[model samples]
Target chain A: MQALFGQLLVGLINGSFYALLSLGLAIIFGLLNVVNFAHGAQYMMGAFAAWMAATYLGVGYFWALLLVPAAMGLVGVAVERLLLRRLYGLDNLYGLLLTFGLTLIAEGLFHQAYGNSGSTYPVPAALRGGVNLGFMYLPLYRAWVVVVSVVVCAASWFVIERTKLGAYLRAGTENPRLLQAFGVNVPLMFTLTYGFGVALAAFAGVMAAPVYQVTPLMGSSVIMVVFAVVVIGGMGSIAGSIFTGIGIGLVEGLTRYLYPEASSVVVFVVMALVLLVRPAGLFGRQR
Target chain B: MSRIPRVACCLAALLAAPTLAADKVSDGVVKIGVLTDMTGYYSDLAGPGSVLAARMAIEDFGGKVLGKPVQLVSADHQLKADVASNTARKWFDQEQVDVIADLVSSSTAGAVMPVAAEKKRITLLSGPGTTAFTGEKCTAYNVHWTYNNWALANGTGREVVRQGGDTWYFVTADYIFGRSLEEDTTKVVKAAGGKVLGFARHPSPGTTDFSSYLLQAQSSGAKIVGLANAGADTVNCIKQANEFGVTPKQSLAGLLVFITDVHSLGLDTAKGMYLTTAFYWDMNDETRKWSERFFAKHKKMPTMVQAGVYSSVMHYLKAVQAAGTDDADAVMAKMKATPVNDFFAKNARIGPDGLLRHDMYLARVKAPGASKKPWDYYEIVKTIPAAEAFPTVEQQACPLAKSASPAVMKK
Candidate 1:
């Protein structure tokens, strides 16, 4: 029973990352209508930025935690204004292709500069140990990641659902022409929305730096899993994405405990099952 | 009449001299093709370092064999099997490359094998890929040098388990390398009276979060969490494990950890961890000298793959010198017969299965406080003999083994 509960906790933690990445993807897609293929690369850049700030620049986790996301967010804003903005007037497929190319370029440049070997980033001193939870020993950092990710996801949900700026952003997304007539700068909102989404991804990367090595190709592999999460959650619903991400993570963790061999394939299998049963998704609206 | 005859002879000699010069140039040049990962995951292992190592070996060998000067031409396999095979075909057909070296990926090596066999050119592997290239897929033209998953797992897992770190949990990368290493190491662990408590398979390359997996390991009650992964994955596991404090109480064993990983992790996070490897920069005096020279030129210590390239190329040249022909079968025969002597080994041999038998070592990570120099990471705790490091002849599953006599098999 303790084992089962332990696996469930594991699943939830994984779900947190899935939720965060998928949420970021959904937010970007909802506003920009551009599937950012470079999201993973940008995510990697965020982690590396954090690692570099800490290692080379002598910045602590506190500063890196704040500045890394902002830096990547600025890069995202620049990318959108300089490059992605031009593709907006064209077919959405062009935007997707552009982002894909950007991902390739980003990954290629990093690989060329750093090689394929990984660079390390240590956890902060405060979160460098585990707490005995009676049922199972919980790593303090892991618990912190879960707590932080949940809080961030909830905060994002609240801001998007409850705030005036979020209402304006949503309005701009739904009817940019009308929003423009209402004396609102819809283009700037779109750019900022994309930047915010990228910032979220970068935020996840910073959170992940101490957990995973900062590698050039780190973003490419996880992006596929995030895409699968997006597909399962239905790109239209943010709440649905959050729930599905965490749900899948728990399922994956349980699978690891019960049948280790099938843990990896379990997510895809669930995805297929979801596709077969609902066609759209659990919370996704029908086309 | 004499002047006319002399002028006609001079013109004839000048025209013939052009053909003679062409013949001499062709005879003196020996082309070697380096097919490796130039732009993918394993590029660091075999890209620039491999090319440099091969060049150094050629220069050290006096750059000539059979009175012919050596020339190297490299191609980016791009970590793709089809691309690697295509490159090998091009090298053999168009350039007439006498040898091909540094095939990085297992699938890439597998693709190049048939082409090497057909072309009758020597192919030397210095990177981790297919053990089958030496085992079931053994070809007369191929030599599986340096380390493989089996050697790595057996050396590390067996030693750790025997030393009472028995209960095992694995945080494996979800890929071929991870799966194979975990599967191979599990056998060693079980054989040593250890149980694999559980395993967590994470996505390859870009998986940044191991919190969930480490939590599972922490809960497993396993004494050791074996990382049957390499490169970015291993480093990430180590970093996260430190954050989670998975080490010290529950030991961490890296099935394949390179010196580069140690440098990245620093001795603080990596301390007290055990790992197995085929080569270390500070293993011996000769190795130190070679490493010093390599580091001076490249600004980084040479990886096992880089060392493997040097060994493979040096041995291949020796085999070619002995065989007197670049024919795959002839060269392979000479290679198997002649003992390999290089920085990595005293006298290695190409076994019947085409696997190069050599010593493997088990080392423990030194604490950050214990380090006396930069890049000094591991302290050698055990040296697995060449015969014990690898699977024996009887355990070998090669087709060639079936034909060998029972007496030969016993030896």
Candidate 2:
């Protein structure tokens, strides 16, 4: 049905955000064994950065597309160096609590500066409208978001699974203490891996800015859902996050079509069910 | 934090001492506190702008009432009722705030109204929409100003139904505000010979996606999809509805909307949508002048909430001056007896049930091309007078309505 296809398209778009955010989370967890709860706030700041660029500097969305991630990665470097690096060897809960605290601080600063009235970042002139595909009408901006997020997810997957750096990263994940003993500079790796993860979050935020209202709470609204996506995909698996993110997004889209009111809760229900069966996530390996 | 700034502050106060002393204000200082959502969803609608408008009213009144200095204090309620109650308690007890104004959310209004009633302090609500605050939840010394759900539904509902668009589907946010909006609009719609197809309830304050809800509304085949939501929820729903192309087939009626929302959603998507509002900055020369002053300070046009705060604060101070006392009962009686004439409202009066029955405008969003300038968003479709816009005497079951009798109301 046309409705089904349309929702599927929507699901894919939402999946793109989930895939990108969770992929970042998974990458950080894989390298540092710390659940970076501030991923959503980082993504939100990326959008704000894009908005600031456009509003103050006359930088367009495309330029923002390239500039925001690299800029937020720098922020990530500072965050990891000054704060996150302190809790490197502590219990994972400390990182979670620390990042969660950081998220509150980041979101709180924006909230204080810009009230909850959402500001719209206008869709770029080039991707302002949509085209009718064979089955459904697809907006150019949304399509661009899906394509770019998938491409990034795939490229990250390839780099992590295939490259020597990825091999070093994976081996570092396996035995960071030994890797540091063998002159791998594991601490710097931890910082870069954390930076790279948060950069991915910022990348998603830039993509999301034009679509959703760029409010401080925008990240919090969907952060829980994305965390569910990461959990359901197996915590640290790269490809697992991508597939499960897209898959859950589609399921979420379908639920919207069938039971509209449950759309927000459907992903959590799926996560609960998946946890009951798999114990890990759908793509996660058993410990 | 420094002695220099402290000295500067004291010097500024000292400079104002001559004006305060010479103004012949009663020797007692009357302190007014503004409690609102400064950091939450309704922040921009009535937050700091409303506070600024209140100060403007005080300045226009020579910043002195009843031969005393009129002081202002404000705190963020964070959109929580408990926070509102605690804040109101602090203002009323510790700070000696005589009146609290510009409470934004119904949850906070509802929470703080009782506290104000217990304290016998005047509470003026400028931003909340639920009339339940005036109906079953009515309390003494509390006035619902600017607008409420009944007025919004009555204004938008009657027009949409009269235009031969009868069948309705509602996408209501799930909350006290949204529920009351739905209830009020349903009454108006059925009264106008319209029938409801069905409705859906989206989670309040958190819903970002509305495609599924819009799709459901689309499938209902209703002529109109009424949005019983406010703030960001309404903006998101309307924007998504535009993307979903539901507008050409089904007219989307924003039951409660703010000028801030219109500014956020460019005229392109918001064009042709019907909304009812109590004030627009460009509605008249007086409004334009007052709003220009407001815009100078805030760098934005005043919303109805901000305008209402100015008008209500002006009315409260004048009542206090007339009664020659800061006593809540005396000032409230004077406020009720006096008719309001301001940039916000002309000949508006507080009814027996403590609802300020001001005229509401049913305005249609102007097309992007038809708009000549920024913030020129609305084309007034109809002006529903106070009598027609608000509920009748018999319709209001407010306990206070029984004793006072709305004979004070003018047709």
DockQ of every model listed? 0.49, 0.42
lDDT per residue (tens digit) for residues A53-130 in model 1: 887899988788889889888999999999999988888899889999998998988887777776877778998777
Q: After superposition, how far is residue A39 of candidate 1 from its true place, in Å?
A: 1.0
Model 1 complex DockQ against the native: 0.49
- Cα deviation at B265, candidate 1, in Å, is 1.9
Tens digit of per-residue lDDT, candidate 1, span B10-77? 99999898555533324456777788877666677668888888898889888987677888889898
Give the per-prediction TM-score of chain B. 0.87, 0.91
**Across residues B1-411, which tens digit of lDDT does each residue of candidate 2 receive?**
789999999999999986565344323679889898876778879888888988998999999876679998888998888999999999888888888999898888889999999999999989898978788888878999899999999899989999998999999987788899999999899999999998988887777877767767877789999999999998888877776667777899999988999987888878888899999888889999999999999877899999999999999999889977787887888898988998888888887788898889999999999999878999998888999888865577888777664454431
Q: After superposition, how far is residue B181 of candidate 1 from its true place, in Å?
A: 4.2
The candidate scoring highest on DockQ is 1
TM-score value, chain A, candidate 1: 0.95
lDDT of all the models against the reference? 0.81, 0.87
